[model samples]
Target: MWRYCSLLAQLVMHLDTFRVSRWLKRWRPPPWPALLLRVAVYSGLWWVITEGSGSGWLGLVLALLIALCAPLNVATWPQQLRWRRLPLFIGFMLKNSLFGALIVAQLALSRRCSANTHTRTYRFRLLKGHPQQLLMANLVNLTPGTLTLRLGCDTLSIHILHYQPQIEAQLMMLESHIAALYGLDHEPWEYEY
Candidate 1:
């Protein structure tokens, strides 16, 4: 009986230690660079939304609040964002946006528009709950004729206005660009029709 009691006490101690370690890990502050980057990005977004209406103090304050309140997983950010690839990613998105606009314009102006709209479910190579996955979904919505209907754990359901052979290729390219931005390898995944 005494031995069993000792073992039980030991187990309880181990469990407590595990809990403490997890708590510390969860509450620890993020790295300085990552924190600063978050603040800058948030501030920039606020500025863009507000169109530089008033003093930048409110934007700075909001940025700080958001940065501090958000969960900071330092391990992910360093591996996720590659600063060198930012320009390429932005340029790719802009170019795709332009092409998408042109396609939409052509379809709109045509007298006999043969629109064959369909929904496609593509398997995303990015891991579930990854920030880049959400960003990619938003970008898809911004692109003309393509709207992200559902973003599941491993699948993305997109509504395509006009089914084109090159649409899948463009989506793949866009995914690759986003993966590159996140410093992740772009791998082919099984997609559903």
Candidate 2:
């Protein structure tokens, strides 16, 4: 019984050491600039929501809380984002959205509506659960006729109202733009139409 108790105590000591090391490894504090930026952005949003009301103390507390927690969840800091490429990405999305809208409008007026509707799953090149991947999914959903049905680890399932061979190319372009915005380098993958 004494030997068993000694072994159990040794195991508990090992677990405590592992837990301490793991906690230490993940305990990095947020950079000062990122924390300040988050505080400023959150405070501005609170101000807008409150319509310049004199609830300054509440806003400050809320802003601080959110700013402190933001770093824990974010994969990349806002400072690391490629701001210069954002305009070009926005333009690309807008152009594609316009074209998609035109195609949807054409399909709506035409007699054959469901003839070209299709659900295709494209293999994603971006890392799973990355912020860029989420943005890509949102942009795809924003475009007419292409709704993101499901976003998986390595695949994105989309419902296209008018299936075209070029749709995959468009998606690849959008993915590349988003990857650029995030300063990520990934090779485009081929998908069957």
Candidate 3:
């Protein structure tokens, strides 16, 4: 719970950190046009996830709620203009979420996806004590079959739902994904420890 709150607080902090009034002196974004673009993206997200889950009105209402949030989402619009991230921003969210869902699902359906198993344990040698390992470990726990038992200073021990050849590879891939997503790999040398 504390972690969740910290993440939310940081996100809200970052969103408000940029001031458009101060920013517009240096760069411009088509405010209404950009707002429309944001609305469209939110609509698309609403369509993708709730498309089949509920009635049309509920989806529309949900999408509108998401649209309502967009203005607050654009705090860095001017800085984005400075960086010219327009093309990248135009791209849709790729459907790679399936891999994560499938991994969680496999852990769920198998009896091993619980907090404990009859005789199950797995140990991981972290490349270093990256904080993301905790998230990775918690994800392992949440997927029904596993739980993170211990996070030693440099190692993680998790009770497995089940073990297989590709699991480590999957975790490694997830680590790289997380690192790239957050640009952790490019952090200044002073942060490496």
Candidate with the greatest TM-score versus the true structure: 2
Which scores better on TM-score, 1 or 3? 1
RMSD (CA, angstroms), candidate 2: 7.3
Model 3 error, position 11 (Å): 41
User: Model 3 over residues 13-66: C-alpha lDDT tens digits?
Assistant: 786677644554544343676656666666677677876665767666666666
Per-model C-alpha RMSD: 8.4, 7.3, 14.8
Name the regions of candidate 1 deviating beyond 4 angstroms.
1-27, 39-66, 69-79, 186-193
**Candidate 2 ranges with C-alpha deviation above 4 Å:** 1-28, 54-58, 70-79, 112-114, 126-129, 186-193
- lDDT per residue for candidate 1 within 1-193, as digits (tens), equals 9999999999989988778657656765666877899899999999999888856999999998888767643444544578898988788778878888998899989999888999999777544455778888999986767999998886889999998788888787788777777766655645444
Best by lDDT: 1
Which stretches in model 3 have alpha-carbon errors above 4 Å?
1-130, 142-146, 186-193
Q: Write the per-residue lDDT of candidate 2 for residues 1-193, one digit (tens) a residue.
A: 9999999999989988778765556656677877787788888899999899849889888998877766446436546577788898789888878987887788778886665789998787654445667787889986767899998886889999777788888788777777788777554644444
Q: Which pairs in model 3 have colliding backbones?
A: 112-145, 112-161, 113-144, 113-145, 113-146, 114-145
Clashes found in each candidate (C-alpha, N, C closer than 3 A): 0, 0, 6
Q: How well does candidate 2 score on lDDT at residue 157?
A: 95
- 1 against 2, candidate with superior TM-score: 2
Flag the better candidate by lDDT, 2 or 3.
2
